[model samples]
Target: MSSPALLPLCLLLLGLAAPVLAEEAPTPAPETPAAPAAVAPALERSQEQQQALMRQLPAEQQKTLQAGDESFLALLMPAARAKAAGTVVLVPGDGESADWPNVVAPVRQQLPTFGWQTISLSLPDPYDPVVAIEQDTAPADTDAQANSEQAAPPVTGGSGTAPAAPTQAEAGSGEPAQAAVAPVDPEAAANAQATRVLARIAAGIDLALQQGASPIVLVGHGTGAYWAARYLAEKEPAEVKQLVLIDAREPQGMPPRLDATMGKTDLQIADLVHAPGAAAQRRKERAAQKANKGYRQIDLPVIPGDRAAEQEQTVRRLRAWLDRLPPAASGSPAAS
Candidate 1:
């Protein structure tokens, strides 16, 4: 039944299909062994704006701005040694950059009395997260178990333990405490703000090391608080002991990322917002706190008076919370 022409035909069919098979197989990209060289960017130096900013400030304030990127970069380093008994980094709310110099003095004034050194840095690029995630990890060779052990406070008094706040309520059956869980858009401002806050956290760690403080804390307001939450959820390591959120704003639609990201054992989160809606949020947070374990959420009522009265009440509550925090922990929230 075999025919020479039939065999030849079969061979022809095979040859015809081979090209199609080869075409379907993807070709791998060429691998380069070396890193590409970095290109120097074109400068858009704003001489007029730069001159104006420099001229308007006092000598010290001007000096801080002119510290230059290169020099400032030199200020940051490995902060593994900057363990408990660390420094605090204070951040303001969004569109609140102008208050930095003014706020810094008061925070600095208050912290040293409680044995915390403070670092004040201006994080202008709060939207780019490519470099700033330094606040959470231990030294590259850090002993994680050791770092944690270092932060645990010694039992020194009669009760020998602080009162723990109850956890927040569970999902569906309960109210949303922090933020409603949702998908995060990679390009959203909240994400970018988180990136910037991460950088500030790193900067704060560097400041702590330079000031000879080891453990670190982050005191954030409004958007800064959102960033703090992000840092804790995404990057906070055992070294970041606490977070302090002052007048923290709306959840800003960043939840799912925070849901699995925040670890209660590593960082303590405290809230101090005074809006009318805070009452509802406070209840949900209290329930969440009770359910979560090892966390507390404090909601101080806004003062019913003029600016002076408001500031006075806020300061008093802040002082009380500060008293609750263990001395020299990272800038994560812990009342007392």
Candidate 2:
């Protein structure tokens, strides 16, 4: 009914009014379901009773467990939170059944109090994704036939030192080795592959240093101690700070050459041999008939033959060692 001239004016008013109203009433935002909160791992979710229930269940029979302890535990020690001024790598003893978790739990529990970072490294599993580490390689100096003749090459000085005689089985001289084992070359063919492990551990030490650590202490349990010693003796003699040998598992004595080798470096050796009473003293006496350095017999009061006892015994020994060590150098990781 409006005139044509008025039509343009009305259209302009409608456009302006519509925009104002539209501006006032915004379109409802499309409903978005809030992202589901990231869930904690099953183990963290479960109470202690639940964790016990999980252990009782056979792996085949387990009904979709929420989280297994080991896998779930990955959350605890992420790289950011893993800064440690000192580290304790708990190396397990030789056995078919390598109990990694049993070693980790107690240390994990105590590590934070001491302001330590603990790594429970799984020793190389043969089927592990890692490269196949050659146990002993032929020396470059020897010819193929000569090398073949020496299956397990005896260790010789590498870094500017004199070579020594290879150890023969102790029984040969009309007596068995101190441990009553046939002396298979006293030094296990140096695993050139373990050289890789030491490299990785060295990287870890470098990382700890990057973060804030002063001295990263190396604690080798059982035979692991020997490896640490050998690693220090052979490879980067200066990389390591302190060495704690829980109990050497070497069936034969640590080759005498190791002391002479380590003596050249700044390495200090401390031994907490199995047990250190009269009977153990005899064992110690017999064991020492072969060593060149001081071997302290660390007495273990409690023998944990059972799983529970083993856990307790390990904790007791570590605490005792920490308590017994003399005051360390100022501002050093060993100071703790």
Q: Pick the candidate with the highest TM-score.
A: 1
Give me the runs in candidate 2 sitting further than 4 Å from their true place: 1-85, 94-105, 126-191, 236-239, 251-268, 275-295, 302-306, 323-336
C-alpha lDDT score of every prediction, in listed order = 0.51, 0.45
Which candidate number has the best lDDT? 1
Model 2 residue pairs with clashes: none
Q: Tell me the deviation in Å of residue 180 in model 1.
A: 38
* TM-score between candidate 2 and the true structure: 0.44
For all predicted structures, in order, the TM-scores are 0.49, 0.44
Q: Write the per-residue lDDT of candidate 1 for residues 58-156, one digit (tens) a residue.
A: 444332322223222111112233333356666655544423433333554455554555554444433322222232222332333334334445545
Model 2: weakest 10-residue lDDT segment is: 66-75
